[model samples]
Target: MKTIAILFIAFCSTISFGQTEKESDIVINNSQQDDTYRAGETIHVNAAIQGDLVTAGGKLIINDSIYEDFTAAGGELFLNDYIADDVRVAAGRITVDAEIGDDLVVFAGEVILTENAVVHGNLKCFAGNIEIHGDVMGNLDIKGADILIDGTVKETSKIVGEDITIGSNAKFHKEVQYWSSEGQMDFKDSLVNTEAYFDEDLGEEKSELSLISLGIASFSLWIFYVLSAFLVILVLHALFKNAFSNAVEGLQNNLLKSFGYGLIYLLGIPLLIVLALVVIIGIPIGLFITTIFIFSLLFGHLIAALLLVYYYKQKKEKDWGFWNITFLALGIAIILRLLTIIPFLGILLSVIILSITYGALTLNVIHSKKQFVKT
Candidate 1:
């Protein structure tokens, strides 16, 4: 717990590193830096980095090489250089025309690996459109709407998509597993020196579900959560329509206050529960506190779903219509659940999200009480 707290604090402190407008629009050319961490509207790096590079902005373009890990988030990212370590990025549009010495983790709307790109380690991507014209030395795990592979893979490749096209020039030294539509497997005979498995009836099944359950399990957890959240929202929207709208309005109206309350709830609850457990006479109380804490944790996703539903629906109009909150919640859940793939800076990310959800819920409850008192 102490370690988790320290890590969370450290992560929080790093959030504002070079976040100023002037400092963010950096274009480093013919320079060397030990480590780089910046947040801006636009970031451009053309110099070598000896250590890790962490940045976030509206637009990020890296034209120099890095000796260590590279992490970034932005509206769009373009990597035109090499990295000696792993690369993790979240962006709207991602274009990699360089080399990754290690693994690659990406969540984006569009991912394009130019012919010059290469990954020496594993590759994982969640995107709407993926076009790979490079080489992957390790396994490739990808989920997208459309995937076009004209690359070479030394290891296995797994893909989940609506439409998957393996260019005639694409080569895989090992097996390939994919899930696609019913009639998309029209190039079976053209595949050479490779075994392919299609999850649906697009082609013959190379391997059964039992063989790939682990891989599926790892990625499908988010999908399941999303479906479940959507279902719950449908019911909640129908029954507690006003409450959902109130929650959303409360959050939007009092972002800072809600976040503050959320922070308190997260840290204070655990301490209170532990203190209650210190006395024999308070055992039942401790148990009750523990239960409530656990319940809060369990309901975290629901709160998120509600928040999302409320925001999405309210944005359609100022007065806000309560009828379609369920569908709006589904849209929000889709986006939140998709972000579950990122795991590098673990607890801090979780804490940030939890705070927002808890805060929104608490703020709504407080406001609801004021209205009750007025009545």
Candidate 2:
């Protein structure tokens, strides 16, 4: 979880490094870095990363080696290299044809582990469709809609899915436990060294909950959140257009400085508020500060979206009309909300965004006051 949080932070922080031109893709070839961070429309890495590799893009292909942990989120992902540590990926489609020294974790629409793929540690995945034809040296845990495993599992295997198929070539050293509405599946006697357990209760429980209803509810909430964020962005732009622009400009010019100031504000303001609350005479002051902090937290992503759109427009040199800018901001907000669907990642991203947004706003105010004094 800690590693996942770091990856999310890296993903957002590296947005500033994205390509300015649409036709150009971010590529790393035969290079070595302590840590790699990249965000773009398309990213291809052929380098040997000496440290962690974190990336977010439209499509990502890694054909090199990662010496440390690997974390990525994208539309499509292809892994054709070696990871010396754990790997965690979230994508629309994923293909793994590499060797992992540690655990393999994935969240996706479709996942395929080619014959060349090998996981030295456990394999845990959640997806819509999963096909495994590789070798897992440790335990295997999978949850999906359609699952077909023709791989070799050296340890126990646990699976839950709507449709589960174990190919004739599948080999399991330990017990194989599967839960499916179709009930027990026929497996070759020689395939499992131990027992095969069918979990009918799990399927019954799942059916009782009605997955369709749950999905609809969750999707509706997501829509509501996105629309609310869009409305907030429009209101903020309408009321404080100039101030917001200045803050984003300050953020653009001093990203690292803004991050530093943001971190201070995120951590320091709370301490000051707590100190103020300890005094009877300062209770009102503390309450006011608390209210402001709450508002900042509530609209952190909106401000971050504004900054992202502003940077994108500046980089592309596009002249966006008022409504166009708002629409762009809305799009960014939607993307941010989607990213938050990943567990643990959302909290970390929220913190980073809140810090940066408030930091930029504070800087803009300071700069404005200084200018007023000069005048």
TM per prediction: 0.51, 0.55
Report lDDT per candidate: 0.68, 0.75
Q: Give the per-residue Cα lDDT of candidate 2 at 77.
A: 90
Write down the TM-score for model 2. Answer: 0.55
| Per-structure clash totals for the candidates | 0, 0
**How does model 1 fare in lDDT?**
0.68
lDDT of 1 by residue, 6-33 (tens): 2322322222231212233667776666
Give the 10-residue window scoring lowest on summed lDDT in candidate 1: 12-21
